[model samples]
Target: MKSTKLIYMILPYTRRELPGWGKLFENLGGYKSELWKDAPIRTIRGKFHQYLMTLDLSSWHERMTYFLGRYYELDIQKFMIEAVKPGDSFIDVGANLGMITLMAARCVTPTGTVHSFEPNPLVFKRLQANVSNNELQQVTLHNCGLAEGESELTLTVVNEELGMGTFTKIPQQDESLISNQYQLTVYRGDDILPEELPGITFIKIDVEGFEPLVIRGLDRTIQRLHPVILTEVVPEHLERGGFSVKELCEIMQNYGYQPLNISTKRSGLRHHLQLTKLTDNQMTENVLWLHPENNLSSRLEKYFKES
Candidate 1:
């Protein structure tokens, strides 16, 4: 059971105030390093939420900012809500505090389930806390990092101010606090998925520079599920990692998926997942792809012809 008892204590107003809180807790002897503890419960939108303390998180504003920033993009939720079939499963990689995971959990409720993974232990704690607080029994949280294979790698914390992080195949050239780095355990989704996860129907991938590596690990899963894949295409980041946008699309196509630019006008339910190459639209950051079985291409073509 989740520990929902409230700790009515003062928060540190300055850096100097932190040590006392640390010492008081440390003296309790139950405070273990990097171990997760249940926090006071709060309510929002008629849902009770548990605030998880994560050392990796820079500040409280980090969670607030992430939620507020993506509030306007309700479109992502709409797609899953409309497209997901009963008993389907959704996978979220680079789940970062699980802003999208919460939505997936609610939409795929009753029969469907959500499998979310976050690399940063700090972020994973918050994600798990939120899931538990909301009583989201259908969403399973994994703390493991996703990569090309089951291996070890170093991850760089981008900046506390930006609340972002990145992983590299090799260590950074120069070490700096802004580029705070840590060695982490990595596993391929192909190798990591449990034997019993229901067939995945949708997937969202946004692992910064490590997208290719993460996708490479999921080739078998992608082929088997033919799930709708929503991924971010960072041309510069991919280029830095020796991957190109073209190569990424080709990889998806080989798995029987077509790229569907969300910017295009929609005609039918099926068009929501069609792959439309966005070579012309340079302004957008990410585009989605749909399996041909989803029938988005034909719906789009018919609409364009009629238009």
Candidate 2:
């Protein structure tokens, strides 16, 4: 068991050192055969680290393997590892398969707790399995979604792309693509109050296009805790969800949150954090929202400056 763990940890580094080694490995007859063969679940070590993921070679899984290269959003993963402190409370809204949740749990170990919320039953089961297999004691999994209110919403699950599930109302023209629609109960962050969420320092939200609604529901939490937020800023998704990207930025600005572009440069793990104006054309996959009052901004600035 110890040897297997060591191999998993070292495999990522080995791939990094060899450059294109992952592609070469994937092209091998033996590795290609495993991908084609029928398998319900196959545990694979991450490309950048020892993180384990149980995949079924579905669209989402294949996408992760090819595009993400197993690490899954390397920049965001690094930011979480560096930004989150021990004992700090982290929230993973739209936790998906527990990738960020698992990473955060490792960063804020011993005393910290990671709250992961995933509404999709099929994806939620996989998330639960990954968290359990890794034995992440710091993670607390929730089976519901988070929104602006405590109402049941229709979740459109795309069979081909499970990760693209959205609670937002879909347009009539695109309704034919929905594989299934399930009723999911969503609760506001304020609804949980100080008891359920105590001193939340960091939050990562990626709910397809429901980002604004989720932020709307967490207004109270943001006003009080002023947690550092890492969220997706996809304009099309936001528009489909009945909210504009401009509105989302305005809401964050109203709450004293400043938008910054956190990108990983070509030179190693260096992060370029720049105060950015949220424009429609400037839409990126992820952006960091920082509160001026919190010392986190200064800390992150210092880290980047030093690095």
Q: 136-195 in candidate 1: lDDT tens per residue?
A: 778888888888888777776765522367774333543444546667898989886754
lDDT, candidate 2, 39-120, per-residue tens:
3455776654466777764343543453344544667876776678788888899988877887787778758888899999
The candidate that wins on lDDT is 2
Against the reference, the lDDT scores of all candidates come to 0.60, 0.72
Clashes of each: 5, 0
- Please provide TM-scores, in order, for all candidate models, with all chains considered together: 0.68, 0.81
Top of the candidates by TM-score: 2
Error of 1 at 255 (Å): 1.8
Tell me the deviation in Å of residue 168 in model 1: 3.0
| Candidate 2, lDDT over the whole model | 0.72
**Cα distance off (Å), candidate 1, residue 305:** 10
